[model samples]
Target chain A: MTFARILQVFKKEMIELRRDKWARFRLVIPPIIQILVFGYAATFEVFGVSTAVLDLDHTQESRDLVSRFVYSDRFQIVKIARNQQEIVDGIDDSDAAIAIVIHPGFAQLLRKGQTAPVQVIVDGTNSNTALIALGYMNEIAATFSRDYMTDHLQRTRDGPPLRGALVTLEQRPWYNSGLNSRWFFVPGVIGTLVLTMIVNLTSFAIVREREVGTLEQIMVTPIQPVEFILGKTFPFFLIGLGEVVLIAGVGTLWFGIPFVGNPLVLLLGTSLFLLSTLAIGLLISTLCMTQQQAFATNFFVVNPLFTLSGFSFPITSMPTVLQWLSYLNPLRYYLVIIRATFLKGVGLSVLWPDMLALAAIGSTLLAVSILRFRKSLD
Target chain B: MSAPDKPKIRVAGLTKRFVGTTAVEGATFDIARGEIFGLVGPDGAGKTTVMRMLAGVMRPDAGSIEIDDVDVVADPEQAKLHLSYMPQRFGLYEDLTVDENIRFYADLFEVPRKLRDERTGPLLAASNMEAFRRRLAGQLSGGMKQKLGLICSLIHTPQVLLLDEPTTGVDPVSRRDFWRILYSLRESGVTILISTAYLDEAERCTRLALFHEGRLRYCDTPKRLKALMPGTLLAITSTAARDLHKALLGRDGVMSVMLVGDGVHAVVDDADRRVPELSAALDAGKIPHGELVRVTPSIEDLFVGLLKDEHAS
Candidate 1:
């Protein structure tokens, strides 16, 4: 409760932090690197995809079709093969990720106003990349055929022999229309980085006290358990707040993502989320004897939380049990609140449940941590 | 606040049980003002548990711990105001500068702004850490770190100081430095209850408590504890020391033969009556042995003899 004592604790921790230069480096640099690397890598918009082409038709129409693929910037032809065997060999050997085959009758069929089939082969080793490449290939092929038919009808001065058989599918993406993965992942990175540091730092604060033999000295002092907990948890709370702001600023300014909701709400939600994560960290520390054990426990929690938090994958797509389990994950709700506020501009009236969930998690974890810490001290 | 006449620390029927194992069993002892009391025992003894209880860190299952008339069990916070505890590992922030650590503890103890510098300056000088005040604690050597731990404990200048095995892993020279600090603290009228595994170091204490298997086997001054040994100790050195030990164990009057470095010290009943027969047995075994000389019983010898007697009774 005393401000002076808390300041004293903070000062001591700062000194310890200053002494560990390597650890300080870890805290600052990794977040920046993660923000930058993940910002560039996480994108749903595919471009410059590597591909190979087998022009067995060896005709002007086939060459023109391949030129369209080249001009779209969707596919970069890495190999120009002479036959079907070469295309199969290239894709089979993993030298090219995708392969295009123009059949021998492709030019004749197009001239006769008949349907011409262009076969696209893709590697499914990494299904996500493979699926995105397939999506681009389908779009390219459909557009090329539609334009070719329109030009053919204009040149012949007659209507096409067959009426339109291909049905047009209208795509309306919800939430993020452009599917800018950076807009989604950059904000999520803020949560991931802040939670990682806050939880890890706060948990180690008390546990390290026990390891270094300082906890006994602190316990023997007039400082109460709550005071000790507050003292240990407060610094990390501030650090977490700083991290959130830093990542948010970078996301908005550098990555061109919008921050549409109230900053106060964002701050409050993140603070509550930080409290819960830190509490979980401290609880783990109490159950562990060594720093290695605490670190390993943190890892065990972090992997599951990140996977189930709906950051990279849609929680709705998960199994029913996993979807329900995501409700128990603090990151799930926080990510929702953050993305909604930053992207959707949703207000507290709409996001109150997430806020309440965070508050509940924070208080429960804090209470349990204090009880366990006090029990261990006694 | 307690009256001046009351003992600084008083523990009666104090016991500590961990799960199914008893760590301390009905330990009753009192340390008067300004005394350096040593709690000596081999590893796994309950010395640390008793110290922790008195320091108000661990609650005893039974009995009361009063520090300067403040009931430690009832109000641990009040008891803390009168005592300082340095655990075995001497918890220190390796990253913090020496001066920062001192300031931190001093601030935690609520030391007055005006007098803080006066109290800390002397401690810094006494521990010879003034030059390295700006250096991190982790950068200091083992002895220096121990010295810094003592300094932090003494920052508030509590009435009693409880150090749990402060010298367990310290080198011999650092152990001496640590003891020197303890003596200085003693001169300053600080009541110190230190636990240690080194028997020779126990000789430095004003009073001693020999603990084993969670029980206080004996509690008295060092001299009195040594005198409690039931039998005379005779040291026999020979070229065939092992054979002499084996042969002497068969002698009727010999109670025990403990190998002491190069020789074996035998605990026997009536040294005069047993000396000739012991020499004859050594001669029969073809082991060349020297004269049996009676020496003063060391704490080690006394403790072993006491355990033997306790087992027999």
Candidate 2:
């Protein structure tokens, strides 16, 4: 309503934020630390899985297979098993994550142009790690067998066995040619971190006043409800935007993630995302009566935003019911826009749908929060 | 839009309920311009509820509240321009300095810098808080925090000020200083309605309203209300005061008996005659007793008497 009143509240809040040591710490230090921490910690690509090898063949072919595992930089051989019992001990003791067993006839089978049977055992404790390890093992074995077969065909002058299987396919991944997981996660850290910071900042800012009894003090004044609400949320919106810039800077400069899309589109997406998160924070503030309650509710609300927003997991892999629910998550759309813009270098033509989704969700949330804000002014 | 003859704040039949229980019922009062009206009651007497409704912060379920002849329930915003309310715990941003806190409230009320500074200087000096202007509110003494709350509330030069238990937990010295500032504000013609749990503060108010269990028991000048007390109150002390309460109940000369902090306060029909009669009776019962003194009737004395009267009838 009145710009002067709203501006005053905004200025007061900014001053408080600046002077509050704990709030300042939460805003400045954690985002940088979290971006650096999560960029490295939240990756999906598996490397250097501890492995045990039981080579009974004692032949060049068996050694070549073991060398492939080493050269691939995927499996680190922690123990060369003398017997079957040792391989079992390595896996059971958690000293090794996976074990490879090459039979005694492996070299004879390969020389006679027959299939080589390789037995692999894995620790299934962390199912995700086990699965990725299996995938890496499969690729390395396929390459080893394909190279061996081509050599055999050149020496013996015989037709290729498993013709289609030995077809040398060269895989070139686009956009993140290295398929680096940091490239994916760093861009997303900007979203998750910003969401967390903005929500906590906005929610705590209002609920702390209610707890401290300032909310009622302000309500008794001549200030309009709209002006108060605008004043309360705008600071957080700017803080959220500033956070995006902070994390994006760290993401590009420190983590070496590329920023390829138009800055305007990123800014637009950040604005919409901030609006929705800040609305969510305000709504939570209205429901709570104390800072402790606000903290718990923010955790309760933001946890789902992270998990269901496809920040770490794929939305398509979720159950149909949850997939439908993801449509309501603002972070879900923002993550898509962030990852797309950062890696694919796509523009509005490909991102308008997500942008529309974000706008719809953000405006809807903001309207409800404002309505609730007005109602709770008493 | 106020007529010269009208009261500054007129609240009629104000009632409010929360969930299924009534917090304030059929409360009616008026505050004249420049008057210090004290709403005195014990905890849960609905004093704060009445102050909240008058401040336009809490909407009464059924009532009309007019501040400066402006309808409050229907047009709270318009009425609020002339109103300032201080809650039981005046919520100051503790991270902010005292000066910053005052400026924030002034900005909220849209007070011009020239006027705010002019008023703040005198008010701060009167409350003796000028030295601590730059201190964070969280770091101030409890007494000074209350003074700052008053300063912030008065920054706008509002016509009506509503303070709910502003000095409930403050020290005696600070409370005296607070009352001195309030008396000065009355000179400027600002009608103040303050809710307090302290009955002794009634002596400082131009008028007082007594509340008990969501109802206004008495509303008038403190002098007039004290005159309405039915009987003389006798302060009887013995080796065991609880025993005195039981022995005096339903006695011939005593109307009712109550325990007041390790002593018995007996409302007797006539203190002159009842004092000797009670002394003789205590001797007969072998209860060790002291000389009886007739204590002046206060708002609390009348409240205890009114509660007894209600229970008897």
Candidate 3:
């Protein structure tokens, strides 16, 4: 391949891309906006869940138990009801996401050293939030019971104070000490945003030329098919790298997500990821006849890729068949590498397998796309 | 015409088929050096197919094309070094400026920087587009775009230039300007092969090949092709031209009658002998006539007669 001819094609495409105002807007603005919006908005951590409480006993013990639920940041007591019917109304009217019903004998049973159960009702419409809310409530109740039994034993028994039969489990979360969901989701957003933009930019590269009649002109030159494909992909590859840096910056500075790994490793992983995405775009362009068809096909391919990449949902949560299917998605490997590097501060030794997978899939995609591109030109 | 000196371009039994249809069949021709050869035909007459094959962009199914002694099908890259093709669309990047478009082609052809700088200014001036060099190609008028396409194709200064319908949709004034540029190029000794659907433009070429239904019907100079008319042609103007046309359709000497403008053009076996019989017939039919005179046959007349013969067979 002649490098000068390839450079000419590359320069021409870059000039046109710079001059096209709509394309420039699409390339820069959407990724920035999407990264910011999805980083803060798309999270599974439930906070400030509106709660209602029905305390029928009116005792100090009952009041103490209600305070435990209110003090936890996960639940906010928005309504205090005198009867069970009021709590039901709060939940049914959607004013409260969770409701607590305390029976009149709650304090009496606890004082008699008998087990007392409190009914916790939750709205199941948003199952993830409801499940997290239930876990918080259970922990609060268990803590309240343990403290009450210890006080009773210390006050009634003599000598060294009879210790109650209780087991305490210490929980320590690693990597993300606070278990911040943004740390998990922001890196995932970077993977998804970069993939979408790069694929879109390269997907229409060739098909647009075909529709506008420029491909025929380029084909008549002495440039080979490989040179043309390289010329078409290199500019978008640079743009994809730029987007990764931009979104990663946004994730770290604006959202307070940590970037602990080596920047060079991130760069290496991103380049490999871009290779596969750009090749997929080239493959789609070869299959389509027009820009509209390319756009439609891009959407069809990108959605499934994002889903199987484990961007939002964990791959382990999917069915066995779909979990196996995720192995074929290059984005899955990239997301693993990105998230690991960002959160865990891991190096090549920890991420070598994922990096190898990315390289394998990327080179294979590039080879297939080159073959398809040559065939289409012929 | 001499066998010793090689022609600039030579084609032998060039054929092309698309899917289930034959677009061009057994076409053969030779173009001399420094001559503007025209491929003239109507739409769907395979003018584009022939131009594409000559451009070395498409392979002919059953023929050989040699350009400057290089086999185009065997080594298109070698042929491309000595030739340039401007397709029907011209494929100008709409977003790029006129100057940028020309520079792009120059770069692809690997034209030397000094040579490009020397040639670009004069080319822009020659096309009368120097004032709009910075304008985007999409914003230019259709005629100006065609001029820019010509400039881009000529930037490399190839030995052979193939243009497909360069003036098809251009305005008449721009068409005249484009031809002026072409003539200047011809004077510089560049061999040109241009295609057009307009029969009038056929007269401008040094020689032309007329195509109909993917077949080469005639290949010669415009003057020679017109001379191949089978019989005498007469132009008849009458107050009731349609009535006169209907009256002369079945006459003894009349070969064919067709309406031309507000008059009737007829081909007869012997115009001098049939004039009296025509007058008597008109008188007998009581149709008043004027300006009934024998005239030279035009290329349009020749083409129509050829089409008629093809249809008859």
Candidate 4:
């Protein structure tokens, strides 16, 4: 409650942090590395899939179909096989992820307006990549068939050519026009990195003091438990904010991820998020007796917060039990605010519910941490 | 000014238990104003536990601690305003310099800038640590660290100062310097309650309390405690000191035999009557004895004898 005492503790902790070269280095370097590493490494978009083709027909129609597959950037033809055994060998050697086999009468069937049996083989070891690649192949085949039907029908029927029976659907994605996965992951990385770093930094604050015998000395002073907790956590809150800005900058400048939201809204949301994380850190510190115990507890707490926050996986896809658990995780609300602000350029009106959730969870955690900290002092 | 007859600190039946073991049991003592009181015991004798309860950092399961007329258990913050405690390991921020550490404590106690400047200069000069103010606390030698710890604890000029084993691992020269600081504080009317493992250090205090197995064995001035020794102590030296020690163990009038540096110091019921009997016993046992003389009983001798009696009972 005493502002002067709180400020005194805050200033002392800040000075120690500034003087410790190792701590300073840790504050800056790891977040930047994490921004670069996770932004690029964690993506679901499949590109440059090595493909092999086995062609039994030497006709122009088969050649043109093979050329269509080669032109799409998603598939790269690594081998052209003459027989079935070679196709199997190429796949077994890991030289190709997809294989296409065309029957001998493929041109004749297409010319005669009959269905052509073409087989597309895919490696299922990486299921996500395989599924996306299959979608791309299906789209390419559908387009080729439409083009053939239009050309053949236009030449045969001259007057006001009748349209085909099939209905073509055109797709346009919003927010992310190109559907680049980087835009999704980079902002999420900011949320995860800030949460983890701030939690770890503050989690060990009190336990380290206890281990080194300073907590006993400080307890003998006239400072209250609330003042002590405030003084210990406020400076780290600012440091966590600095890390947010740093990682966001890296995400925007280095990775070309857009920052489309109001800076003020981002700041507000970030403040609430920092409060929750810092409170959780103080709570962990109160429960533990040593820095090692604090570190271990942090690992158990942060991993679930990160995973269930929908950082890499969608919360909707998680089981019902885990989905409900994610609602209690403050990082989930923060990630929603961050992604909405960064990608959709939304303001408080769009993110008010998430922001409210964050405030509710944050204040509750802060109150609990304060109570636990007071008990620990006794 | 406070009344002279009133005690500065009062305690009654302080007890603390940890899980399955009792750390301090039914301990009661009073410390007068402006006196350097010492709690003397070996490791695990509840010295630290007693100091912690008095400092208000820890609460006893069953006890009443009144410091400067304030109940520390009910209102520790108010009690803490007039007290400072330096734990067994005085917590100093290792990354901070000595000056910064002192400033931090000054701030926590809300000492004004003017008063801090006035007080810090004299304390540093007295401790001879003015030159090392800018050195990091982690970089200072062990002796200097202890001095700095004392300086930090004394910055706010509290009425009562509690130090728990402040000189356990410190070198002898630094230990002497530390006592000098305590003496000056005593001259300024500060009540100091210090715990120490060294019997020599206990002798420097105005009064001492001896603890064993979480219980108080004796509490009085050092002179009075030494006078409580049961019998006359005689120091016996001989080339066959070990054989003579064995020969004199069960002889008549011999109460106890303690080995002290290549000789045996024994307590006898009557020195006049027992010395001849002891010599005759040593002669019968074919032990050659050199010199035997009476010596004053030290605090160690008194405690050892007291411990033996407690065991026998």
DockQ winner, 2 or 4:
2
lDDT of 1 by residue, A1-378 (tens): 688887788777766666678877777778888899889987767777789998889898999989988887878889998887888899888888988898899999999989999988888886888898888778877888888886776777765464435688798986678877788899998888777887788777777888887887788878778877777777788778878887887788898998888998898899889988888888887887778888988999888998999888889899999999988899998998899889988888999999999999889988998899888886
The residue-by-residue lDDT of candidate 4 on A80-102, one tens digit each, is 99899989998888899999999
Q: Can you write out model 4's per-residue Cα lDDT over B36-102, one digit (the tens) per residue?
A: 9999877899998899888887889998999878999899889888998998899999989999999
Root-mean-square deviation of candidate 2 = 2.8
Model 1 misplacement above 4 A: A18-24, A55-68, A80-85, A101-119, A144-178, B1-8, B122-135, B169-189
When 3 and 4 are scored with lDDT, the better candidate is 4
Per-residue alpha-carbon lDDT of candidate 3 for residues A1-378, written as tens digits (9 for 90 to 100): 889888888898899888888987887789889987887688787789999999888789989999998888999999998888888899899999999888889889988889988888898998989998898888888889888988998998888977789777787988898888888888998889888888888888789888877888877766677888888789999998888888898889998889999999999999999999999999999999899999999999999999999888889999999999899898999999999899898999988999899999999999999998876864
Interface RMSD of each: 1.3, 1.0, 1.3, 1.0
Give the C-alpha lDDT of model 4.
0.90
Residue pairs in steric clash, candidate 4? none
Kept native contacts, as fractions per model, are 0.90, 0.91, 0.66, 0.90
Which of the two, 1 or 3, has more TM-score?
1
Candidate 2 structure, TM-score to reference: 0.94
For lDDT, candidate 1 versus 3, the one ahead is 3
Total clashes, candidate 2?
Answer: 0
Candidate 1 lDDT, tens digit per residue, B1-313? 1334767788899999999899999999888898889998877889889988988889899988888778999998888887899998887777788887888788888998767899888887776778999898888988888888989888899889999888777778777777888888888899999987788888889889988999998998888888777678999887777877778775688887788876899988898888887777777778988889898988888888787778777
- Please tell me which predicted candidate would have the highest lDDT against the true structure: 4
Highest TM-score model number: 2
| Model 1 residue B5 distance off true place after TM-score fit, in angstroms | 7.7
